[model samples]
Target: MAGTTDSGTGEYGGTGGVAPDRAGPAAAPPAGTAANPGPRRSSWRYIGPGIVVAATGVGAGDLVATLIAGSTFGYTLLWAAIIGCVVKISLAEAAGRWHLATGTTLFEGWRSLGHWTTVYFAVYVVVWGFVYGATAMSSSALPLVALFPEGPGLKTWAVITGLVGLVFVWFNRYAVFEKVMTVLIGMKFLIVMYVAIRVAPRLGDAVAGLVPVLPDGSLLYTLGLIGGVGGTITMAAYGYWVNAKGWTDSRWMKVMRLDNRVAYITTGFFVVAMLIIGAELLHSSQIALTSGDRGLIDLGTILEDRFGVVTAKLFLVGFFATSFGALIGVWHGVSLMFADFVDRFIRERFGVDTEDMVEMVASGQRERSFMFRAYLLWLTFPPIGLLFLDEPFGLVVVYGVLGAFFMPFLALTLIWLLNSGRTPAQWRNGLLSNVMLTAAGLLFVVLCAKQVKDLIW
Candidate 1:
């Protein structure tokens, strides 16, 4: 079912994307001392990628989920939100490990798994990107439209935002992209953290939330909160970000771990802040909002009424920062993914060799590649139509199903890849990793099933 072609620059080695150069066993470094050079760098230096992942992964929907959790169960579910960060930390760390240990992109790692993995991912990015494009733009636009109501309609703002994100990612390299995202994250943290503090979170109640206690009849919501706090397909993109950040060697493992923790710690703070808002604002007032992005708008209105217009506007701006940050992050990170996917697919299906394509991508050269721009267009232009019309019910259902399954897919696959011989032995999963990944896998499976059932029923 494969063919041969001769249309590539001959960078990798063999035809069809095979790098005879890279196919041999990875050079295993001593435990904790592989490719790392020099005395260990300060942990602060390795922080960009995690911020990108955190900014990308936690969007409007996640905040809504956290807000609702706090609104429904008050501070009781706070532990679940923190646990969610821990789970994601394990997943992201495993992903970064694969790239560092194996010296291959995650897509390359997936290809090593089987043709099925490649095919599944190919189908996934296309479908997921199309739907997510509209959703992200819309989410980003909500705050913009809120801020400037008379300027344009939501669809217009969505289109403009999409185009802006497209241009921004289409032109910038990883360094600039990271810098821009950091600034936006700074704005996001200032607004959300400020609001949370202003809400006057109860110290005793928050401390009690650190303990694991579920309120009556709230088990599923608690699980959803724990499982949903700051997860997305973007977690898979973490490794690519790691590679993009020039941390390809295993020597950077320690820094990567610290970076991952800081990323989720930031995420945990945002989630906790939203929970504080929900508990103190909604729970105390016995108010409930509708779910999803609109729920955020409702929350904005509530904030304005209770606090003031300035607070409401600030929160909306934070909402925009979170959403737009995700927009550009996915635009850049996933484009890198799709470009790798395309190059590898060509090699697999058509036998064209690109030689050092992995290096090309990891070095941020792919940001300017034709395939990366094509997928960027694919993510941008096609979804603008969805902003104009209602999303088709069937397509919506399929998107939901695929979205539901992605995290579990990531969890199980990381577990498989890390434990297998494909990875350097020294880089394989530790017992703690195995335990956490298994637990994450099971939790996501249950969550995925529930999502599918909800869609069907």
Candidate 2:
């Protein structure tokens, strides 16, 4: 009841009588206050959460998927990659909008839908985190293993990476986290663009790629490219980052939208650059990359052979940045979501009088909340065992199915929440927003169906 509002004015005025000691210090002055006047313009300087989300979203798997598409279909599916970024921009914007307009976390909005959402998300975060932790660590470890063959083995590096991420996230606040993510993103951008340019992409053909075309037998890759470019649950995490950044109300809406667009535009470049590398370097030679993170290691080896040792080493460093950035991003972002989930669940089920979700976020208590640290540890430690053992086949299937459904779930639910009375009318989705979200929901639904079908059969 703390964050509930009947006025629909989209402003959260107070902390609903929660004790002063529990509320902690407000992490930021309320929007429009003298200490925190809303931005006069949507400046690039306001860009933080978007970069974190983009860097986190485009992990090694995304890069590999885009690379494989280019290797298989050349530049024919390039239009789909660009469209994917556009679609994600809409989704991230919508998520951030919901938070600012409603003065609640996305999980709070999800809980408003039904008890069933609670059930679904409870299972999803647990299973998804367990698997993803191992996966993220392994992905981050691949480049390290490749770079220092004489050093630790894969499992060792994975454990080391996990601990490093945990320590980094545990000790740092949002400000430090954002700074580190930004630095890593810079490394990733430079290396990816360098490779894209160094490949001397056929300018005429790449430009031609802007036009939509589906080559014969290219349907699946086209779909994957569209649905897969820099899309993930972290998109849902964008709002939490917005709140963490101290942009806690509708006044910050313009800044959020600008940040969201810059995020995907950067993501589009990453996807396109990887595509260019796959097309120019691997496709011409009929070389195939092994799927998943190993494929990047393969690309690094190829870069060494073709460019020189320094270039290859730089690419490996970039790969590490991409992987580890995602590792910490999720460690921070999803843990925030999980903390909010537990907070809301306790308040609802046990009738605990907690601070408003916006208050929790803005007061910085959310980051230091017990549930937050618990989930952070959940994301880091249990998965280390997974690194040593083979992931059970059944668990893998569950993870894939849950992962597949998440995007559609996010898109369709946003449509429900934003279009309903829960959000301020001015903040609701417009015609173009509806169209894009509908398209994204359908695309992901198709992708989900295929994934489940493959898992079952």
lDDT winner:
2
lDDT of each: 0.82, 0.84
lDDT of model 2 at residue 335?
95
**Residue pairs in candidate 1 whose N, alpha carbon or C atoms collide under 3 angstroms:** 11-354, 11-355, 12-354, 12-355, 16-347, 16-351, 36-251
TM-score of each: 0.91, 0.93
Query: lDDT per residue, candidate 1, 117-189, as tens digits?
Result: 8868877889999999999999998888889988998999999999999999987889999999998888999
Model 1, stretches more than 4 Å misplaced?
1-39, 354-359
Clashes of 1: 7
How good is model 2 by TM-score? 0.93
The superposed Cα distance between candidate 2 and the true structure at residue 445, in angstroms, equals 0.7
Residue by residue across 1-457, what tens digits does model 2's lDDT show? 0122322243223411112332223334546677556676678888899999988999989999999988988888889999989889888988998877766678777877989889988999999999999999999999999899999999999999999999999888999999999999999999999988998999999999999988998887688788887858898999999988888776777788888888999999999999999999988899999988899999999999999999999999999999999999999999999888887788778877344644655566577777888888999889998888889999999999998989999999998997886766666777888888889899999999998999989
Question: Candidate 2: which stretches are off by over 4 Å?
Answer: 1-30, 34-36, 353-360
